[model samples]
Target: MFKPIKSLAFATLGLAIAAPVMAEEVNLYSYRQPELLKPLTDAFEAETGIDVNVAYLSKGMVERLTAEGKRSPADLVLTVDISRLSAVVEAGLTQPVQSDVLTANVPAAYHDPDGQWWGLTTRARVVYASKDRVKPGEVTTYEDLADPKWKGRICTRSGTHAYNVALTAAVIHHLGEDGAKQWLEGVKANLARKPQGNDRAQVKAIWAGECDIAIGNTYYMGKMLEDPEQKAWADSVNIVFPVFEGGGAHVNISGVALTKSAPNKENALKLMEFLTSPKAQQIYAEANHEYPIAPGSEPGELVKSWGSFTADDVNLMELAKLRPAALRIIEEVDFDG
Candidate 1:
């Protein structure tokens, strides 16, 4: 269920503008598409008997929250990527939540040190290699993507895209700014064409022989396999987890946070805890094709079949902090030009 922005009542001078409804409900402002969250939200609603109302925002989530201030009815904000999560926290739109369940389910590296946001699931930034054109062991490290040998065989989305920027930020963490800049330049010089299209489009290019390999999130392979029109694109490639030299694979997360202006705090907390529960985590893995973060929780069978790699040890908050620098380096290299 989704609530229209206009349907919410504002509180003034600590007084409600309209009488409150009796039924328990939690309002969510989410950047994640609603369909991806339906199963998890439905399960939470069913088990707790709490109605879930979602307002999907494509952009300006921070701006809207800032404008609403104390009048905002949103109890929680759900989004993907650490950068967006950090932005909301930086804006002070979210409040820190301390819970034994959240702390235990999410590894320290995947959540905020101060508990501003909690990671629910993670997805790796991996390579999509053509099964026919590329051999296994040919591409093993993030550094190898810049090799001269594969100069004309690579494809990617825009350098400034959040996914790529996060990957660049991870590179910055591993090798200072100077090293990361050079690597970006190397990768730019290796592009088969101007960085254009989404991650799945890169896979389509592989099927069409436009390129041999491309960088994309691991879950996209699952999505592609599910689409009849895109199944061939998925079947044409192998999922490859590349490591940052001396580090493991780079990954990002889908996370949730409690808003500062929560109208139904207790119910919102219940939903947050439910999101990290083993049952909800399993639904997230099976329904959305993401890797669950809960203790003893495992990826759906399809995800498990793709194989696994140790996640890079650097905390995601560090990557969020470096995003600006990463964008600067990407611009300096004229990666899309």
Candidate 2:
């Protein structure tokens, strides 16, 4: 049962021809652009003969979903952050899914305990250190980023951005609120410049000799390497996995959930299950340069070359819970100013 297609953002993937009979389809509201998800959706459509329709959303997904309520054509939601996924669940926009296939493919630490959402891929929040300026093993822990030795030698994106806020929330989970505050203050003191720019911009700063190291996600290296203009920036740095004092490296995910008002529940479930399978996981992860969470699905050659580290065992939903506190501390410190 197809509803009125309101805008160009909601377009059906051109993977397979529509069935002559009642065409089966699953609508997705995704933060990812349609082209980015084409590989995965194309594969799913080819395998199951279910058309995948995508609505690309930049922000305000919760409000949009709420406005549509039970009449929404959206069956699935694909978003990048744990906080976003948790927000949907908290807003009563998502329903818990029960499936042996999902549970077996995704690890317990990567999913909501109540099955509200499941992680598809993870990206480690890692350090990008200058190959010529920063020595190997010079920085081995997130705690060390606050050291005076690094004073006036670090660059990062705005503290209030979702990625940095998520990292701060992880720090809060590892350290207490007071400890996290001190860490934020120390990091602020060491900043080479005011917090500005996205993660890639930080790397460009390092390449331009503005800073010796920067906080960024691992996948950006792959992204930069592929870009003609940014390749030099990618070549100038080495990926480093910094750990918490007593924990493993910090990691975050891009995940998916079933919307509460799913019009095509069965087709959505089929697509969800197929997405977690090894083949789809590989396609999805490779396309986005992220780490696949499913068993038997390994990262691409470029990603594997970055090396590996044990991911911090803290359940991601806890990090989502700490986001507010993290944002409050960042505001208190005026890290961007």
Candidate 3:
């Protein structure tokens, strides 16, 4: 009788042990599409056996997090670009995270000065040109896009786009707002067609002969080259590394941060550290065709193929600080109109 009782006690204790293990989970709020992020999420889950629950939305994540407030169940926030990250920080939705791995991997320029966020990967603002229409040597600098010679031959996404907006902000940092405005207006005047579509669409427009030049993030070119449906767009254009004469190529980041009211603070910190680890950095670069934040880590084949170019290295937060001004200038110039 005592042996049966002992066996039952053991089973009960086993279940109690498993309960906490099963409860070891982390919730994530991400602006990245699920398909694009699955690989990294899967790796994290496999490595730590920590179940990850993710809510993926293309927009309104900041507003949602703000609304959730201290009652929010989110532990981590992941998104693209410093502007959105800065918005989250400005809204007080994120809190300081002091992970040595993160600080070591992500350069100071690519992270929040107050430790609210850290960049994981980066994309370059590069040019794509019509292979048959434009010569490489003829277009070497972003300032050249403003020259009258390239007039009536350029294509780009709407200036309101965060990528273009950030690039414009970088320009403003290098040139005063007044000079940046003139450059923006000149580029707008040179548009071969009304600014429309994402970066890939700009490439498609070039393929259709609507324009001879387009500005886009480098990863989009890799995506187009890999997707069968987008092959024609890739084949029709050649990429150009247009360093701004004084500023170098503008770059943007995909970043992560801890939520202000995270219930799983310890777990969230672990995740942040894991993300910046060399292994995770490799995953970021390989899966996303983005440059790793960790120095000396290889940037995957697609990014490596683009060759090395100088990055502007402007403090990304400065881009955020200038966001309102940039948007105002974009509007005042009637960029979309």
lDDT of 1 by residue, 137-175 (tens): 999999999898888899999999999999999999999
By lDDT, highest first, what's the ranking? 1, 2, 3
lDDT for each candidate structure = 0.89, 0.89, 0.82
Candidate 2 Cα misplacement greater than 4 A, ranges? 1-23
lDDT of 3 by residue, 182-224 (tens): 9999999999888898999999998998899999998887888
After TM-score superposition, what is the CA distance of residue 289 in candidate 3 from its true location, in Å?
1.3
Q: Find the 10 residues in a row with the least total lDDT in model 3.
A: 1-10
lDDT of 1 at 61: 88
Per-residue lDDT of model 2, residues 1-337, tens digit only: 2222322233332222222222487888898888888888878878888778777888888988887777677889999988889889999999999999999999999999999999999999999999999999999999999999999999999999898999999999999999999999999999999988899999999999999999999988988999999999999999999999999999999999999988788998998899888899999889989999999889998899999899999999999999999999999988999
Q: Model 1: runs farther than 4 Å from truth?
A: 1-23
Q: Which candidate wins on TM-score? A: 1
- Using TM-score as the measure, name the better of candidate 1 and candidate 3: 1
The Cα error of candidate 1 at residue 152, in Å, is 1.1
**TM-score-best of 2 and 3:** 2
Q: Cα deviation of 71 in candidate 1 (Å)?
A: 0.5
Against the true structure, candidate 1 reaches a TM-score of: 0.94
